[model samples]
Target: MNNTVPEDGEQLRAAVRERYSRSVGPLLANQPNSANSCCSSDCCTPPSTQDVRDTTSTDCCSTDCCSTSQADPITGDLYNAAELGTLPIAAVLASRGCGNPTALAELKEGEKVLDLGSGGGIDVLLSARRVGPGGFAYGLDMTDDMLAIAERNRQEAGIQNVQFLKGIIEDIPLPNDSIDVIISNCVINLAADKGQVLREAQRVLVPGGRFAVSDIIFQGQIPPALRSDLESWAGCIAGALEENVYRQLLQQAGFTDIEVEVTRRYTLEEIAAGGARASIAVLNEEERRQTEGKFVSAFIRARKPAKQV
Candidate 1:
């Protein structure tokens, strides 16, 4: 609940890790039909920025994006009932992603795949099925609780083609040119250094490997005052890159044919109604006006071209 943003990379990483680790318990306890209730009518209204400035800590996730209970609208609707039927209920409950990367990754049989920030292994399990027995899927996550749950889900599913590794997305553990496809679900925006994450992704991919992910992107400029708040970063708001900047980052990472397709656009009203309401509610009327219709969840696609002869 600390209001101040972490000043250094290590601090930022620790804060994010702590937040996600704490979220696991609530996610497990959430019911199938539950929606994010963090900012519902029953909850208390958000305090003004000046009032919060005097407070020592603020639960940014509960107030903003960290809460992933059944009430969380952002994590739901990404999976179909048929897909949900194939995995443990716990896996489906643990999903905190914004999009279904496996559905769009175009995974082929016998292709090796990697998922960055593979929270509860839902996408990994789905990818394993798509790749069949001849292929393998690897999931990388930094949180021990999430990894444990993911492994438990993997066991429950009785799948043999998937393995979950412990690591940060910015510094992937895999070797270079070893993977055919890289996918992530709403995780890159959480990284302290997105450029490094992209670079690591590029380094691990074999030439011709595809980069497919779902993430939050901004279409217009966020108010400078809003952009500087670290609390918003942890909530998946402050960290989102502008659409063009996202493309340039991919280009800089040696990716070709970058495409960002919007899957869901968030309005200020929608945010105000969701788990992140407390965060958005703190904005003044003018700031609220600036943010409307600017943020979107997108499916980003790019490719590492074939190696030169």
Candidate 2:
């Protein structure tokens, strides 16, 4: 994995798009089914934590590849067993979210919800069920393969009130003040311009609408070298803003009652155990120690103030 961040805006966006596009192919091929056939005859069974540490040659940043082992602790055990059973098998298998936003978003009946970076439509399907037939759900994603899979999952689940749109999170395609609630799962940290993403979220939300998401957040400063790594950025590390900075950005984007609640914190030992050794491989022992307890998966909540008369 390349360790250097792309300095050019367009270049960075292209890099992210290409990485995700390549990952979707393998993920789609590996979707679990009744036959339980492997993606390939030579496919190794799902890897364990030790297996991930032993295999240092693979690109640990590739979501499709590394996630097959379930070594990335950030993405697992988010939804409960019953919740997983309710969605299409493909949706359940394709989910890569860090947290269960649908569970925490407190969705209500007859509400209109939009999911940013709605990979595989897991949250959208879940949200659709929560909001019921009287409500609607919209999923927006930039990757064609993910969108395709999400749409297929929606059809398979026989859901009628959900729609998927292709677009970047920084520039939502919805009209202003159109959404009742906005939700996302671990996808915001992948954006190169988070402030813009928040602004767009605020723009499309109705006054008093809620902003609820599960995302990576940092508590302390990360070394500049780590922050500049392209792999770290793609893996939801380098792009994570410190908790205070994250809250400030939300306030700057015109959101109020900003609250960032920590859901899970990652220790350095856990990182090495979780198949992200590549991210820490460059760090010296002391630098690695500095990272302990600094990174967290947070449930961020904020609101767009009600419209004034």
Candidate 3:
């Protein structure tokens, strides 16, 4: 795999840790409390469009796709319990995902699962319940604050079958071929070395074990100017890889049946305005138009092909 860890990788990692640590706990808590309220995108307005024609769904394209979107803090159907739901909301508030991992993972009862960058324990809690008493779920993340939040959530939810570990997705802290499924959400792009991340994911999964994730993927090349802007990169736009690159990376990592399904596409305006805060909105008119409708969020699925020949 290419060693593309930018010289700024360490700095970027620090920035990410600091940023998410401060805001994530509160953000997850607010998700269910403010169901219809504008998510992170409510903070900024996207650029006005003057194109001849428009062609994207408002649901598929957030007005400000560049910003972080709050997750459904409650584990799927689990927090519905009147007693559990009434507990201090931390358990329900640990999710930071774009798509529902439980739904895509197709997890079976008693199957082992691993969640990469499992923030706030949202997906882990849900997965644990899905696997029932026989299955187990493990969450791995590098941020101490995130792990703390997740641990709190796990305790609050009384989910004994799940385990939280401190680790990077690019260098997982688990035994190889031990997990039956892997899931992640909107976290992979934040890595400076996605190639290493995928390889690590492949290394940890059992044969035929599933890999399902939701993340941002560029439809084509992002201009050089946009690529280097750290704010844009951290906001999940500039650092995105092209769709083909996603496929190639997974294939190269020994994953099979790679699928890069575009769940939603974001126009340039959408991404720039995503978190409702964009440092890139300063671009000129032509530059703005050049990038319209160029990015997407996808539900990617692949498998560690059942013990290759």
Candidate 4:
């Protein structure tokens, strides 16, 4: 994967915003039987932005605003039956996560948690349940449509300790050192400025706070053509960082104990997109093969220093 994110920041943002906005129909419609990912032909859903999202839960889907890939390579089987059973079908369906950050985060009974790019509030609601009444969970997302879906799901779930905020991950609205733990689900990789995002995450967490997230990262080389494709970026595949770069960024952001553990490798066939006009079309069979083992889902962990230097 490339080290630099797409330079056209506004275009990237617009690509993301448009994709998620169209998803409003199926998301709020509360369609029965949840899809594995937000925008998949598997479930006949529209373009996805899981977490409202930073993508691909979403580092969410869509290489084209109206088109989608053949499989949800980054989403699926992250949530357990117990977790799924506890949430609304829409919330479960709207989930755009690469991993269950809440489960891996090991949230305590009284911890303030923040979910950057908290799409439909799945992690937020779950965190509220874990943190209990004394603690709180805040879900931040840039898409109002996704926020509406989150709010609807929140009301349906009847969980009181959670609030969904409207904002992007790069510029979190909360005060500095105001949070206990920071979590994101496959969303950070979607940001055009991942450095700023990590910095903001660092800024908001209390000293000694934790950073646990599920995201898509690369282990090896990515085609230069793919890196330049803005649509692939919107779909989550184009914008991810190599694992080493991810660790370096965290360290530069004043984090310690950083770790990037791969959970799954996306096979070549799984990355196929049926849509003729989809963004992944840039990758022919050879390009797809080159990408086979390079792309992976990872659980990244880091902690802010006990005292900032």
Candidate 5:
């Protein structure tokens, strides 16, 4: 079946908002998940050539998409036990990222940090701790419910250095060249206008500031008929860009020293069983050839040029 949601942002954005809010509704209502983790779908690899389920939740949307799901292939156990222990249960449960950018970003004390889709504020809190009280961590999210949960998580953590902002990543509320670093987890792929997002990112980062983030990227061909349908595979994994395209976009946005490191790869299977919409969904043999071996969860790093003097 064909999906038109890609041509627009509001529909996909709304789906993300509603889906993420529901992921934490149980905990927000004082009822924790027995499993202690709610997960988003994995990346869009569609499984191996043998048609076997990869068991990776890496394809489409998730509750957070990047939470601590040990059983999930895409949204694997990203946070270590030590990292998990430090966060409030709500923060841990509300996580929805594909990678741990805060852990990977090499943040220094007193650095100003920003989390793009900072759902539930997992990375923000972690960065706050990493940067210490001398540093400030900011989380930017469009969802009110997610922001509310994040604020509560911040309070519970007692991180006075953190602030949660209500805004979309495409248009950050902060000033240009005001941030020292920017980070995101599996959230960039959700944006409909990726170029605009990158432009905004470049605008906010300070000279020599680092742009370290984790995201989903695709390579190879996706037939028009199935692209959005597969994207409907769910949450943040939707609207992924090709690896090379992502690099080009970064360069065009005036970022330098760009690097994309693959942390996990995702595969998809036919919609025969346990599929979101088995009957209507279509990713047959011809398409699977191009689709398989293409999706990956990556940590993309870049930097704004140092001041020219």
Candidate 6:
């Protein structure tokens, strides 16, 4: 139903670029319309920027990337507590994530935090407060539009300890072992080379530093047609590495204590509502049914071994 992999990747990237560019203007004003939130959908058309906060759908996840506390897998303790009230409006508005890294990261006060694929700086802004004036946060994104929006957010928030860098995750612009913690939200699966992402996460982090991310991980092998589907890739389903493979890749990259925890699985209806079928025809009945409600979004936590002398 979908085109080959390369085609999907390009389309997804384009959608991301366009959506962020459009949302940038709204983000700077700090009166963001929730409907404008951009995710893999500009590629997959998942939840609109605004639809992410629907209590009936997203449930416990706040649009604010700052809420990092743990919650029940089924009963939804995380959703009920809503422990992330400390974030700035910019953060809540710019958030385009599936999980909250701030809670999962277990960040200490004054430790440096780096957000890969920082987007409009939702996680970065949230992390800035956690680290306080003694600590710093760095948001790295490849999109110039996103970087500009982040900078505006930084200025508006009056946060001096945060900086935005324009770059990709596979080849980060930061120095070696320069960060104390790394956090990302639904961004890593988008990279063309996830291994390089793991490697870079290791390279930039100090020994014992943690990699906390909220991403989509597959339960099993995705269909070849879906795997090669660029729109699906952008939508965050196609490119997802299986759970076991993700753990293995982390270990191979010298990360330890790896944890891949599944939190939610999207229904076929949800996927279709979010626009996951945009690139291909929703023609095949089997394809439509197979894709319905099958993707899982989870929090991924791992650590780089303390430097070995």
Separately for all candidates shown, the number of backbone clashes (residues 3 or more apart, or on different chains) is: 8, 0, 12, 13, 19, 16
Please estimate how well model 4 matches the true structure, expressed as its whole-model Cα lDDT: 0.74
Off by over 4 Å in 1: 26-71, 273-275
Which regions of candidate 5 fall more than 4 Å away from where they truly are? 1-6, 33-70, 230-233, 269-281
- Model 2 scores worst on lDDT over the 10 consecutive residues at 34-43
User: What TM-score goes with each of the models?
Assistant: 0.84, 0.85, 0.77, 0.83, 0.83, 0.76
- Winner by TM-score between candidate 3 and candidate 1: 1
12-98: candidate 5 lDDT, tens digit per residue: 677666666766676576544322111432322112111222234332222233332323455556777577667776676567677
Measured on C-alpha atoms, candidate 1 has an lDDT of 0.76
RMSD of 4: 7.3
Best by TM-score: 2
Write the residue-wise lDDT of candidate 6 on 204-225 in tens digits. Answer: 9998898888887777656566
lDDT of each: 0.76, 0.77, 0.66, 0.74, 0.72, 0.67
Local accuracy of candidate 2 as per-residue lDDT tens digits, 40-134: 11122233222323344333322344455433456655767567667765676566577888999999999999999997899999999999999
Q: Which stretches of candidate 4 lie over 4 Å from their true place?
A: 1-6, 32-41, 44-71, 273-289
Stretches of candidate 2 off by over 4 Å are 30-71, 272-275
Best by lDDT: 2
Which residue runs does candidate 6 get wrong by more than 4 Å? 1-4, 7-19, 22-90, 279-293
User: On a 0 to 1 TM-score scale, where does candidate 1 land against the true structure?
Assistant: 0.84
Clashes of 2: 0
Candidate 1: C-alpha RMSD to true structure equals: 9.1
Comparison by lDDT, 1 against 3, better one: 1
lDDT of 3 at 198: 96
Stretch of 10 with least lDDT, candidate 6: 71-80
Superposed Cα deviation of residue 129, candidate 5 (Å): 0.4
The 10-residue segment with the lowest total lDDT in model 4: 57-66
